[model samples]
Target: MSGENETVTYRVEDHVAVITLNRPEQRNALNFDAYDRLERAFRQAVRDPDARCVIVTGADPAFCSGDDVREIMAGPKPAIPPPPTVRHAPTPAAMAALECDKPVIAAVNGAAVGWGMELALYADIRIASEKAKFAELFIKRGLTCDVGGFYRLPAIVGPAKAAELLFTGDVIDADEALRIGLVREVAPHAELMDRARALAARIACNPPLALRYMKEGLRRAAYGDPRELGGWAIETIRTLMKTEDHREGVASFLEKRAPVFTGR
Candidate 1:
């Protein structure tokens, strides 16, 4: 079904809920509003009994370029308040994809950077287009990995490889991602979605209840308590938000120039 907001759209076909990130003009870069809508879409897929599998992909030319840096920088800042005794809870949006027990696939047709990369990681399987690229770009933004990247990336790509990508914030082509096990398969750009749907259909043919239980078992085996890691990531990002490096990162990004970091 088409979403109320155009930033994200959802539809079900042959037992697969196909969710598309729709902001191609900005390379599907998300702001807070888009993120909220995406979370809702994921939740809807989970609740739909007929959706045995879910496929997430973006509009042509980009999957998602992470958060909209311009929007983040230009948005009004909230007033600082005293810290509460309890730690801040993670946002539901961050965990929405993972909360689904049914199989989920990422049809990475183009650039998937930062949060986009994390979103793809949340999927049980990833099918990439030859034109696709992947990156963990939070370091360049002077931010820690968010949206479960720290918990998921190492599990998918191994700890050492994950560190290199996370530290350098380097972009890798689809072939590189495939070689490193970040994606299960890569197809030509024109045929990426068809490949993803075929895979989703194959999985959907299995007993749905058994598939759900198997998915939960696999997840439990693969991930630790995400709550602790997610909490730490959030707090680290909060601290980074106040840093001079982060401010410079945003300013340099907006100005289209190299950022001069002082290690502040």
Candidate 2:
């Protein structure tokens, strides 16, 4: 970690990896450094065998404030993105986390806007604090949200609601987040992380391979045509059935005792 050490930090406990956005003073606003750190951290988490699940949250009050406009203005600003023929589109870190074998839970502690809200949308589950506020505020800034926001939101909340949120850029609090099916639960600010951690721990206690299969199965099923995707799913299910964890899961169910999976 360089001077960007304050950008993002990764920590692991009880088989749960937590990635925290650390620039609370800036409302954890992201720039190049934060994006780079996030991409790197997600890649590392994907490869870490010790990680059974992940929880993403902020280090301080706000979960994130989206992009840092001041930094963008000071830097070389492209008036508008040039033709797609020239540059490749950037990949979102949240997508990387979502596609990983381990499940992710987002602990939304405070304000989550634009890219920040997109990041939370990537998680398998979201738990927001009572003070948490969410908005897809790209319209307010005269920008458009990236892939995670555009694709995941509609899928999560259906077309009409997603359109309402994105098109208007209205701020929504935790209760609305739950009503719209955006958050799993809303807790007091102090208990948000603990609730997230407890959920992660429960998921971690399960057979890791089963969890992986479950996650992968659902992901592929989303927007996947059964005609073509069914083949891959068949192979995937066949492979999962042969794993030691699969056998352990069956035996554990019969024995009425928890399974001790070794991630095999």
Q: Which candidate tops TM-score? A: 1
Regions of model 1 farther than 4 Å from truth: 1-5, 77-89
Listed in order, each prediction's TM-score against the native is 0.94, 0.78
lDDT of 1: 0.85
For candidate 2, what is the TM-score?
0.78
- Residues 1-264 of candidate 1: C-alpha lDDT, one tens digit per residue: 495458999899789999899999999998776887898999999899889999999998899888888776445742112235435534456668878888999999999998899899889999999999999998997888874578889888899999999999999999999999999998999999989999999999999999999999999998855766766777788788888998888889988999999999
Write candidate 2's Cα lDDT for 1-264 as tens digits: 323466988888889999899898888888877877887777777888898999889867899888665564224652222324422232435435555678989999999997899888878899999999999876554345655565578888888999999888899999999998999899999999889999999999999889999988887776332222323333343455456675565456446787677667
Clashes of each: 2, 0
Native-to-model Cα distance after best TM-score fit, residue 175 in candidate 1, in Å: 0.7
Q: Candidate 2: which pairs clash?
A: none
